[model samples]
Target chain A: MNALNLLRIAVKALQRNKLRAFLTMLGIIIGVAAVITMMSIGEGSRRSIESNLTSMGSNMITISPSSNSPGVRMSGSSIQSLTVNDVIALRNQATNLTAVSPMVSASGQVIKGALNWSTSIQGASPEYLDIRKLEVSEGISFDESDVRSSAKVCLLGKTVIDNLFPNGENPVGQIIRFNKIPFQVIGVLASKGQSGFGQDQDDIIIAPYTTVQNRVLASTYFQSIFTSAISEAASEAASEEITRILRETHRLRATEENDFSVRTQAELINTLNTTMGMLTALLTSVASISLVIGGIGIMNIMYVSVTERTREIGLRMSIGARPVDILMQFLIEAILISITGGVIGVIIGVSASVLVSGILNWPTVISEPSIVISFLVCALTGVFFGYYPAQKASRLDPIEALRYE
Target chain B: MSKILEIHDLKREFKVGSEIVRALKGVSFDVGTGEFITIMGTSGSGKSTLLNVLGCLDKPSSGTYLLDGVDLKSLNRNQLAQFRNTKIGFVFQAYNLLPRTSALENVELPLLYNPSINTKERRERAIQALEAVKLADRFDHTPNQLSGGQQQRVAIARALVNEPVMILADEATGNLDTRTSYEIMSLMQELNQVQKKTIVFVTHEPDIASFSSRTIMLRDGKVQKDTPNENLQSAREALNSLPVTEDY
Candidate 1:
């Protein structure tokens, strides 16, 4: 028989039991939707993390002093062996480095006109803002002369500004007390929101390193040295150059281990991305199980339908329908059900992803490749599961089938 | 008229759990074109087996059967289906019209298997067949909407839609009442006399068998009797004498 006629007959048969056909398609619908939702969510989070890392400066690197004590383990930032001289040495020697700053931080209560807030106070050179990709929204940043003269000028991040000066007050050129020492507000850093670890990024106060070393903490050792490479591709070379300069400046012997650790932003981002990728793969695989189960459900229904329509097969054969025609009829019916379900699934999946993003406030991105792959998988499932049942229908004996009760 | 079907020493056997049961024991017969013949026998008399063999639905174990000069045993499954599509039409005892399908679509079914017929011609031929059966107004109605006799008529129309070489009907009016049975037989009589269509009908009812031009009685897997009806009854006259029912 011609394909169109066969299809029409198959459709007519399916129409006889519309509810059963829809129920059979339900399995495939749920499977495809689940896969799409899981994949989109995973992709969204990965993209979010990548954007966050770039915002924090992709080529930025941090160098912290490691504890020199033998057989003792300590947090690298707690050793405090890095000094202003080491930063100067690296700044002069590292060719690939675009900018470098010595960082010293201390937390203290700051008061501005009876508005008091306790926040971390960071001290660094003017290069700190450029290396960290921080911009001044108002007023001016502290210059090199301010760091050399130990000028008591500071910049406040948006969070610190909100906490210390409410009602969007302009605190520029105003005096704010930090540990009972009065400092002039130089500028307000632009907002950076929260970090990937959920920590508030814009909750710090910035001052010249000389002022924090002499007056706030009364210390000469640097806590950490932050630097940025000229370009993303130069990060590794810049890291190596900084490590060599620091080791030489500290005068560590060949046999002695260097008292420093260098970390690149790219490395941290890669580790985070790897973890996210694993999670996405794990979720997608789990969702695919439902698709396989859906295929099995189709097979189960097809077998039942073949058995139910044995007499029909006989009648068609007696009316001059070839075995191949019977087979094509059944096979086309299966494909029609699955492909219809797949199209519905794609719509449901996209809508569900949008709902998740809207209601739960989670990021979700639907990739084109995922939709294409899921559609192909659905078609393959129909063919694979429908084969044996269609074959059984085609191979039936006309005499016995006609006689079947 | 020329002979349309020739059979010689036709035999059919079935293995029933290690024992071979012979269904057709070397039965032979010839049917001429435009002839209306009936093969009559009781249950277990192998007349049904003979019908199946004649319809090309079952192969003979050891026999030579030819239709229009072509060997039946030489044809494969697909070729047999093709042969049936072009050369023979079947009307079952149950009517066997597909349930929930319109009578027009059911009539068009056999033509669907013929690749040479297009959709438009198939429809036109199905309508013509239905018109011949006097069921043109009921083309859109499903089988369930029709009476037993009407359903049988639709089945006959389906059988005739392909314009096959011969019509093979097995107990075509077995489910109908006496009056409806006469009505269907009259229609078959008109088709045989006016359209010159050859027909082979199988039934155990002697009264139904009296309408055919020839009668063949089968017994113990063999032909017990084969003879022309010397006093053939006209179903049209019989229907004219019967009382008309309110449903008709």
Candidate 2:
């Protein structure tokens, strides 16, 4: 018989018991839906994490004093290993770096009349705003001359402005006292909601390095150095260049370990991507177990169908249907059940992903590859599971099957 | 007349719990074209086994059986299936019409296995067979919607659709009432007389056997008597003579 007739026969048989066929397909539907949803969620989180890192400056690299430096180990914040001389060496010698700035921070209370607010004071050069992707919403930033002359001018963050200058008063060009020394607010920093670590990014103050060093902290050693590469792809090269410059400027011997650590945002992004990929793989595997169970369900139903249709098989055989024809009939029926269920599952999975994102405000991305893979898996599952029952029907003895009740 | 079936010393054996049971023991028979013959036997008399062999459904353990020039012993299982599809039609006691299928489709079943017959030709042939059985008007009715007599007619149409050389029936009237049985026998008689079709029917009813021109009586796995009936009864006359009932 031709394949089309066999398919028609199989379809007719399934139509005879529509409820049973639908129930048999339920397992595959749930399995495919679960796999798609889980993978979409995993991919969504990965993309959002990447975007968050990019917002913090994709090409930004941080240089800090290494606690594991040769000699007595020192704590991270108390380490006086980095200096302005190292920053100047990196700014002048590093070929891949586009911008560099030295950082010196001190926590103290600020007073603007009777309203006082306590926040950290960050001291850096003019290029600090560009390297960290921070913007000044109003007025102007402290320039190169401000850093050279130790000018008493600083920028107010959104949180400090909300507190020190309450009642909607603008803080730019106003005078504020820090550690009993008067300073003029040069500009207002734009709001940066929060870091990936859930810390408020706008709860700080920015001033020239010379002002904080001479008039506030009174320390010569810098806490850290921040720099930006020409591009995100060049961060690795820029980091290596900074390491070389710092090592040479610190005068470390060939056998001695460098006293500084170079870290790039690219490294952090890679770590997060690897972790997300593994999570997606794990979830997809778990969901495929349900698919396996669904296949087993198909096999079980096929067995029952073969048994129930024994006499019909005998009748067909007597009418000259070959063993291969009978086999194809039952096998095609099984494949139809699974493939139909797979199509429905893909629709449901995509809608569920959208619904999840809509209701929970979570990021979700539906991928085409997952849908394609699920289809292939469903087809394979049908063939693999349907073989034994179809063979059983084909091998039935016509006489015995005719006599079956 | 040309011989449609030639069987020589055919034997069939079965192993039941390590004991050999000979269902047919050295039986021989011949049937000519346009002949109507009935094989009569009680239960366990090997009549069913002989019919199965004649229908090309079972292979004889020994000896040769030929149907329409094809050696039944030499052909493999697949070839035998093809031979059965093209050469022999079967009508069972239960009618064997697929449930929930239209009478036309049931008649089309045998032609479906023949790759040479396209869809349009298959449908035309099925309708012609149903017309031959005088069931053309009920072609759209499913088996459950038709009477037992109508269902048997549909089964006969299915048998005739492929234009086989022989119609092999196993207790074809066993499930019908006396009147319906006579009606089915009349239809078969009409096909044999008008269409020139050979028929080999298996039955235990002597009254049913009287309708055929020849009788082969089997007993104890052996053919006890093979003889031409001197007074063959016309099934149309027998059906007409029966009194009409309100239930029918």
- Point out where model 2 deviates above 4 Å: A69-72, A110-118, A156-169, A177-183
TM-score of chain B as predicted in candidate 1: 0.97
Local accuracy of candidate 1 as per-residue lDDT tens digits, B91-200: 98888788888999899988888888888999999999999999979999999999999999999999998998899999988999999999999999999999999999
TM-score of 1: 0.94
Task: Single out the weakest 10-residue window by summed lDDT for candidate 2 chain A.
Answer: A67-76
Error of 1 at A51 (Å): 1.9
Q: For model 1, how does the per-residue alpha-carbon lDDT over A285-316 read when each residue is reduced to its tens digit?
A: 99999999988989999999999888888878
Error of 1 at A148 (Å): 2.4
Error of 2 at B192 (Å): 2.2
TM-scores, one per candidate: 0.94, 0.93
DockQ of 2: 0.68
Error of 1 at B219 (Å): 1.6
